[model samples]
Every structure is written in structure tokens, then in C-alpha cells.
Target: MVAIHLTSSFLLIRHFIPFMKKKGWGRIVNISSINGLIAMPGKAPYCFMKHALIGLTKAVALETAENGITCNAVCPAYVETELVMKQIRDRANQNNISYEEMRVAALVGFLCSDEAGSVTGCAIPVDAGYTAR
Candidate 1:
């Protein structure tokens, strides 16, 4: 889980950074969860990895800020992917809570574009206002 969530991103970033640096422009976006920002019961490993991912995003963003490269993480709550759907089902059953879907593609697209060149080192939440609570 650590490798899948955190180490893989680190390795990929390390591998691509030089190429991006040479090219003079790049965008590195990571998919994180609300767990990255807030803690929930019975999700320690997942939360830990996600939080580390945010930290990685910020650190890498700083490292490559001046090189026409940006790194950011999108922290969404229960996106509508298959794996997430399963988790949501399980969680809903366990806690008897309602569910909602959120998508990060548009924000990710914006982040990858020239308009967001000035935006870096951000853990932007796309949690349908759940973080507001």
C-alpha cells in the first residue's frame, strides 16, 4: 500500500523530473483522497499514505517550481471509480450514510494547462463541500 500510494509517485516523479526539467515545462498531478486532509476511524494506513502523498506533492512542487513545472494533488471524496464504488458500498452498509460522487478531471485539466502555471504546491479538495464540515 505504501509503495502503491506514495513510493510509486515518488519514483515516477524522480524518473520524469529530469526530462521535464530539460523540456522546460511539465505538470505532475497526484490523486489523493479526503483522507489525506482529515482523519476517519478504521482507515489509518490509507489516511497515512494519502497524507504522505500530499506532502510529496508539496515538496516536489517546491523543488520544480522555477522550472516551468507544477505539481499538485487533487483530494476528492469517494470518486466514482470501481474500487471506490466498492468501498463506498461497504462503508455505506457499515455506517448507514449517504453517498455522493466527485470528479477531478476538469480541475486536473486546468492544472495541466498554461493558465494554472502559477498554481503549485496545492492540495486542492474536490469533496462536494464535505471538507467544510
Candidate 2:
């Protein structure tokens, strides 16, 4: 989980940030989870990695902001992906609620665009208000 959520980002940033620095523009968007902002019962390891990912996003944002680069995270809710479905099945008895399918691609797209140049180091939630509770 650490490798998947943290190390991969670190490697990608280390690899590509040099080019971004040369070009003087870049955007790094990390797909975090709503769990990064909140907590789920019995998901300590997963939650820890997600939270660390947000921390990484912030640190990278600060490190590269002076070079016209922006780094942010989009924290979406359960999206019915195969991996999530497996977890859902394992916790079926615990959660009986349904989730509206909220799209995150648009938010990611915006974060990658010029309009969001000043929006670095944010963990914007696309969780259909789940974190509001």
C-alpha cells in the first residue's frame, strides 16, 4: 500500500519534475480517497497511506511552486472500482448505504489546466459531501 500510494508518486515526481522545471510549468495530480480526510473502521493501514499521500502532495507542491508547477490531490469517495468492490464485498454487512456516482475526471482535468495555477497543495474532496459529515 505504501508503495502504491506513496513511493510511486515520489518516483514519478523525482523523474518528471526536472523536465517540468526546465519547461517552467507542471501539474501533479494524485488520486487520493475520501478516507484520506476521514477514517473508516478497520482500515488503518489503507488510511495511513492515503493520509501520507496528501502529505506528500503538500510537500511537493511547496517544493515546486516556485517553478510554475502545481501539485494537488483529488480525494474521491467509493467509486465501485474492482479493488473497491472487493472491499465492499468484505464489508457488505457493515455498510448498507448506496453512493451516487460522482465523477472525478473533470476535477482532475481542471487541476491540470492553467486556470488552477494557484490551487496547489489542496486535497479537494469529490466525495458527494461524505466528508462534510
Candidate 3:
């Protein structure tokens, strides 16, 4: 994940900075995760790596600010993706619960409203408000 995400981001900045320099404007949005902000019980590695990515985004943002390049990290908690469904299943298995139960427990009553968009420069908990409590 680090290689794919961080490495690619570094490469993009290296390769695209010249173009951005000529154009005088650019926006780079890195897809970070809420794990980067708040640690979970069983996802230490993911949390650590994502935190690192956030750091990278901040560094890049600072480096390119004078160049009119904006680098930011978008931290979404849990979107309804296939990979997330698999995680739900895994959680179900780990907790010995029904899939539906796990899904509800995973998502119900813990979501963020779209207006939360104002939050940035850190992880955004789109996890149905998982971190709210």
C-alpha cells in the first residue's frame, strides 16, 4: 500500500511539478483514510501507513504552496466499496455474528453528513460517525 500510494504520489510530484510550474497552478489530492487520524484496535499497520501518507501530503502541500500547487489529503472513513464489504465479512467472522448484524454494527448510527466537508488537513470520519463518540 505504501509503495502503491506514497511512491506513486512522490513520482507524480516529481514528474508533474515541471508541468505545474509552467502552468502555475495544480491540485494534488491524496486519498488518505480515517485510520490515519485515529487508530483502531486491529489495524495498526494500516493506521501507521495512512498517518505517514498524511504527513507526506502536508509536506508536499507546504513545499508547493509558493508554486501555486495545492496538495491535500482526503480521508474518508468507510465508503460502500467491495473491499469494505469484505472487511465487514471479516469482522463478522471475527465476532461470530451475522453479516447483517456486523454490517449494522459497523455502520449504523455513526455516519457523517455531507456538510462535514469543511473538515480537512486531517482524517475525516465518513464512517457513519464512528469516531463521534
* Clashes (N, CA, C under 3 Å) per candidate: 0, 0, 4
Clashes of 1: 0
Q: lDDT of candidate 3 vs native?
A: 0.63
* Higher-ranked by lDDT: 2 or 3: 2
Local distance difference test, per candidate?
0.89, 0.86, 0.63
Tens digit of per-residue lDDT, candidate 2, span 1-133: 8889889988998999999999999999998898889989999998999999999999999999999999999998755687787654444434443333355777889999999999999999876566897
Q: How far is candidate 3 from the true structure (C-alpha RMSD, Å)?
A: 7.5
**Model 2, residue pairs in steric clash:** none
Which regions of candidate 2 fall more than 4 Å away from where they truly are? 80-101
lDDT of 1 by residue, 8-49 (tens): 999999999999999999999999989999999999999999
Clashing pairs in 1: none
What does candidate 3 score on TM? 0.65
Say which prediction, candidate 2 or candidate 3, comes out ahead on TM-score: 2
Q: Please give the distance, in angstroms, between residue 110's alpha carbon in candidate 1 and its true position after superposition.
A: 0.7
Worst 10 residues of 1 by lDDT: 94-103
Can you write out model 3's per-residue Cα lDDT over 63-122, one digit (the tens) per residue? 776766666666665444786988766656765766665332222222222332233233
